[model samples]
Target chain A: MPPRKPASKDPEPLPRSARKDLTRAKLLQAALTLMGEGRSFTSLGLREIAREAGLVPNAFYRHFRNTDELGLVLVEDVGITLRRLLREARKMDVAPRDMLRRSVSVYLEYVKLNRLQFLFISSERSGGSRILRLAIRNDVTHFTNEMAQDFRIRGLYAQLPTASLQMVCGMIVMTMLAAATDVLDLPPDQPLLEAEMSENFVQQLKIILFGATRLNDALTRS
Target chain B: MPPRKPASKDPEPLPRSARKDLTRAKLLQAALTLMGEGRSFTSLGLREIAREAGLVPNAFYRHFRNTDELGLVLVEDVGITLRRLLREARKMDVAPRDMLRRSVSVYLEYVKLNRLQFLFISSERSGGSRILRLAIRNDVTHFTNEMAQDFRIRGLYAQLPTASLQMVCGMIVMTMLAAATDVLDLPPDQPLLEAEMSENFVQQLKIILFGATRLNDALTRS
Candidate 1:
């Protein structure tokens, strides 16, 4: 099969297409929630997702070419969701520490809400349909590039090259990926709530940010 | 179907049992190699893994109840491997920084040699297998407890409790996992060659250690 195309835009949204898009969105949303509950996209069937969305199995094809294609959509959805959270969270005039605390909460909440999608994206690097994997890598690259721009704009990473910024972003994202999952048995649904898990996250962020900031400090000291 | 039990201990290591255990180990080893190639565990099948191990499909059942069960075993194996690496690495008579650098190199080399198992464990939790997910969590707890004991014996974590030490271990494992998996896409297997990745790892460790040390120092000064 030809590589599945991402949802295309039309100058004017057709009701039929809009409905299909809505159905697709709903399926993705349901999948994300299911993932949060610990379902894998590989094992998740299109029929089950459609059933969750209260649609017939045939209706799923109207949106996604197949389940693997839907997984790509889900991966893209996670990127969009996370970016949206970052954007909205950025609007708050809080200290970086406070913002990070809030961000952790928001991040966990996103995982809880879209568990399946978050897990799906998290696991994408491992065995998955080829198309889905590429989409995930694309999302990672896009997000990294986006963050470089954000950090540059804020002057936080003004001295760093895009590569270093990407490394920092990669580290942060990877740490968060570990945090977002229950692999650590953190003794809390959201580690941000547990004093221990939350403190660890705070310190982990501090260590990462400190390392980034200090790299600049070292360069200046030299 | 009932959950599969791992192999039993025997003095002589029965021919069939030993053979089953070796096949499982071989499959895991094969998975690790495949992981370096960027394949996730979910995308792989039993037949392929068994075939890779020069065994027939039915022979796989003698080892694992299913691929997910095999994934759980892989997680356990990774924890053991990592803990062994830390133990062996720490025994080297060198500067802490140099020791750490070499440790990372060893880690990368190990992953390069055992790609499938590492990738399987890394991808398991997010891949939505209950057994694998729980196994990863349990192994993490096991690792944290081990780290906490080591820290206590060395009196290294006086400033932090065992819980906090475990969290630190969790964060370090997260960073290591990220580094090992090529999640950063460091020029496609370039993390091993790039002095920067190991340098960053050491720097991050220093920041964690010294940052906490300095916090205590500052408190004393204040």
Candidate 2:
């Protein structure tokens, strides 16, 4: 007898604030997917992105001023995500080699999860929106500084100077992005087997880290 | 004027074929410049590139279909240059350590000299141009094969398989790009001033080779 009642006429729409955040997040996610597919932000229009997010073109402005602003926000988010991954890895009690391996696993995992944001930052280093480029530099600077502190605390870098550590961090970031983009296979978006690539990635990273460490030791002895 | 030239007039423009090649080269050069400045080809218009090359818009299509075609040509040029650089370096009589050091020097020197071309290829990875992306991959494959041959001849890599050597080559490519990006801010690009960074690069390459060699040796002993 209770089944006779009709469904409610309408469900409530998202609250204005919630809807705004949702729209922004949707746009960013869409951007990440598009960018991951090797599409550059320059070739991407706001309307195209808005359509991808299933929102009207004008509604895009409700979340941000324009695509560039949206990209900057995405870059910052990527930076934060990258930093958090490093921080979490630092807390684990794994062997240094395993820690790096896990770090790379997390890195590849993050890229898979946030492909667009990573692609945006990666592409910007070469062909990104102006705001995205600036954001990348700013974020990488902050990231390098963070690593410098970690290196100092670990005393693994006692012989090397602070700037040296920054250089290593920068090298690592560049290599990471280069490796990620290479494996992603640019436009047409081939799905790389992350598990296999991550294994190779760890080996490469270890080679870099081990080599850096030994070189520092050799110089100290000399 | 000594008996002034009779019927003085401007020389006819370059021959049609000559003009076409000149235009193609100019377009490629302009693409490199813009790409080197971190501009994406997709975002850049044919007119702007034509302007950069000191040509009118219609003159652009005379050379190529679009900027994507121009980009692929530039990628091929880059690969050829790199191949030549390595081939020349391979002919020098130097110790393995010195050879690697010199190879790195050559690489960095090339980047400095051909900054635009190098930057363009690195940044154009994510451009939605199929042919251009394939060109990049072709170059990478060619470079890897060349490096593999070098390792085979050196005997240092005799114990490692061809695939492993290719992996090392990939690492080398990745590291060289990272170094050129100056993302690390490691001194100036001056090879002499960059002794530390350059040394670091060589040391890392050495470690990868040496480490693999040692690992293989240990396995044999076991």
Candidate 3:
């Protein structure tokens, strides 16, 4: 008997594009898990990552050209994710003091939710990979620029020069990154230590914001 | 003729202890050079470091049990070097504004002189190795405590609470470290970029100090 052709009405259960996306995501997840385990990306092997994702070594090439390419993608993804979250946090209408506290709280909460991504960015910010380091720095520069714009819109530090505003924004980014590093480094068993770290981070931001306000006032008077 | 034993009046050309000390110093120097070249200590191999130092792999054991131990020694040496330089900077009797500028100048000079050591500390501060990260943090904490003590002696920040004093000192240290990282990461031929970073650092510190003085005044009035 002759074989009958399938009708066009029947749809494919899982399309090729979707399956490829799943595999790519799995590879990224594997990398994030390994980094979350305290291993830097430079120390990770392509084969190890592929194996963790349950694929053959050659399958990695289908997703990424190499580990550095994968790392760049990861850095970009984390940067976008963080900026989106922070932007959302800034949308809240609150007093300046409350806004500062709320922004920090939102940031810390994001770090908690995306522990591996935060850890990867913080660790690789000064890690061995120059490309990854540059990517993180670029993202940080973008973040600072956005922050400076926000400050300008709010008329905060309006009297300061553009360079000074960038400096203040840069300080805020660095301090937040440092706090995230400290939080991620804490052992999981030490809840008290984590709480203290969170509180201290808030207090540190308060001090910095206070100083920034005073500087703005002085510059205006001068 | 049989080799004659050294006479009581004859001194050894290179004493065993002195030779051992030189070998140890060579190892540390080799590691610093590697780190300055953008290779993190955690990514470095023991054999490679020994080879760079012109010593056999086994010879490394005499100086350190492992790379982590060598890293610990490096951290300690950098900490001591920085503390000594900062202490010298603090000894200058000048007005508070001039003092801030001078201290920053002195610190930047030290960074210029010891670029490798500073790079090592900054890179490893948030690097992969937990032990190295902890060692750097401990040194930073020690530096902050010493700064707080000096502040107490000079009646600086006298109106602030002890925790607030430490917070200010911690912010200063973190800011300096961030600036150091920027300077180290700059291209060697970019002197203009380096100068701008240095100028920006000084200005940033001035803003912080100005804010700190205001805080002190407000607390005093309250």
Over A1-222, each residue of candidate 3 has an lDDT whose tens digit, in order, gives 533645555455588899899899999999998887778777888998999889999999998999999999999899888688758857774576566666777788788888998898888888768999999889988988898888888788899888888988888888899999988888775878877777777767766677777778877888
As a whole number from 0 to 100, the lDDT of residue A21 in candidate 1 is 71
Question: In candidate 2 chain A, where is summed lDDT lowest over 10 consecutive residues?
Answer: A185-194
After superposition, candidate 3 runs with Cα above 4 Å error: A1-12, A189-191, B1-12
**lDDT at B177 for candidate 2?**
65
Residue pairs of candidate 3 with colliding backbone atoms: none
Model 3, residue B155: displacement in angstroms? 0.5
Window of ten residues with lowest summed lDDT in model 2 chain B: B181-190
Query: Candidate 1 lDDT (Cα, whole model)?
Result: 0.67
| DockQ-based ranking | 3, 2, 1
Docking class of 1: acceptable
Q: Candidate 2: deviation at residue B67, Å?
A: 2.1
Most lDDT-accurate candidate:
3
Candidate 3 chain A weakest ten by summed lDDT: A1-10
| Cα distance off (Å), candidate 3, residue B29 | 1.6
Specify the highest-TM-score model's number. Answer: 3
Off by over 4 Å in 1: A1-14, A33-37, A51-59, A94-103, A106-116, A125-127, A157-162, A182-195, B1-39, B43-64, B94-97, B151-158, B183-203, B216-222
